[model samples]
Target: MSVNESNPRQLKLLAAVRERGAATVEELAQLLDVTLQTVRRDVQRLAEAGLLARFHGGVRVPGSTTENIAHGQREALNAEGKSRIARAVAGEVPNGCSLILNVGTTAEAIARALLRHSGLRVITNNLNVAGILAANAQCEVIVAGGTVRSRDRAVVGETAVDFMRQFRVDIAVVGCSGIEADGTVRDFDLREVKVAQAILAQGREVWLAADASKFNRLAMVQLAELSRFDRLFTDAPPPAPFPDLLERAQVRCVVAGADATGDPTP
Candidate 1:
């Protein structure tokens, strides 16, 4: 096929990369039906455009890359509030249960709470969670192997979804980038939704843990219907159509301990 300039071959290549979850030059060449040299040229151009990440002989989704941050840095940002919310979520997980934790900063807090518990198996795509649990002697933590999105340290793509289906989880603890009055779950990265959906399939119950900021904004992908989740944990009461929507969807809303002041907040 001839490449189009307005929506050029590089764009097509990036879209294809997003779809196939491929991370290398070889994989891109095979998928695009081009030569290695051509793939290299396309890749170089895409890299220059900030549309793709160049790895050794491969590429990765820019926003989904896994990362490591010092505990001090994480703790400094809303530490006490996140800790309370995490503790509340941890109470929901009984001993001897399997859970799927999504890749989000808030969900990382929940995973932190889980680190103190025993006999709980957590399958996750969050590198932050995985690392925390690695030091814990109590919980069994399994990382979903796939291309790591360095930006968020979220494991994503076909391989991650494929691995998630191997076992069922008692609960899937997830964080959404945004929420709608209609009870829709949203995220900017559509590929991450594929991984989230897979995790949903494995869980008997789905709990969405979102901060107040998730309201109003719209994330690009809808991982699943809000009705699919059994519970929604948030720092404050939902606004407007949110309550009605969640009621219609039959999702129980659990508000965390108000806000930092122990009063009602978003």
Candidate 2:
């Protein structure tokens, strides 16, 4: 089934598993206030769609090193978290500055959040991001020239990498398919990785925008190390090792959707 066809319960189920990392059949049933059979059915459907990975008794977010989730599924997954991350990133972005946004659903969300900002120059390799930011009259949107990936309207390859080298931006906002325990950021496509690396090289400061679901997940191509980023914006505090990793890397971690006192919402 398409992501749009997923019911509210299914979405909630996904959120529960995402927040907890994993949940058993009984746990999910109780959390959703549904029968065990119903939860099983939903899990089966979501697992079949590659939105979740099923083990003997529970489900968790998929952890495929060689393949990223489908674009639509990724958009639907952790959507609220992505929005929070976007807002946090946007809050830090100064007006009248130039930035490069790489390809991802989260980057598209950031584009939407940036609509109100004026006198901004935004360069992107994602068509969706370009389209979203195009509505902002005050923001100059530049699209890189390259072969577009039909899956998510991302422009990648050597041409895109070359296109990004033309300017040194104030910040590069990027997302990854996964962040490993060893502090390696990763993605599934080598061409996309190359383009992202180029974008990072051109930025005076680099920021990573990703949801908590990406923690400890796996992806094939090594994008960059966590140390490369100056900041990390996400919805929740990262699990163990990452806090130490970020501290060592000297990357500031900003938890969005936090209370006014600056504590993460429970």
Highest TM-score scorer: 2
For each of the candidates, the C-alpha root-mean-square deviation to the true structure, in angstroms, is 14.6, 4.2
Worst 10 residues of 2 by lDDT: 257-266
RMSD of candidate 1 to true structure, Å:
14.6
Task: Tell me the tens digit of each residue's lDDT in model 2 across 84-145.
Answer: 77877887889999999999999998998889999999999999999999999999999999
Give Cα-based local distance difference scores for all models.
Answer: 0.71, 0.86
Question: How big is the RMSD of model 2?
Answer: 4.2
Q: What is the lDDT of residue 54 in candidate 1?
A: 80
TM-score of candidate 1 versus the correct structure, residues matched by position: 0.68
lDDT of 1 by residue, 24-101 (tens): 787778777889998887776555544457878887655632332323333333344465567778877787888999
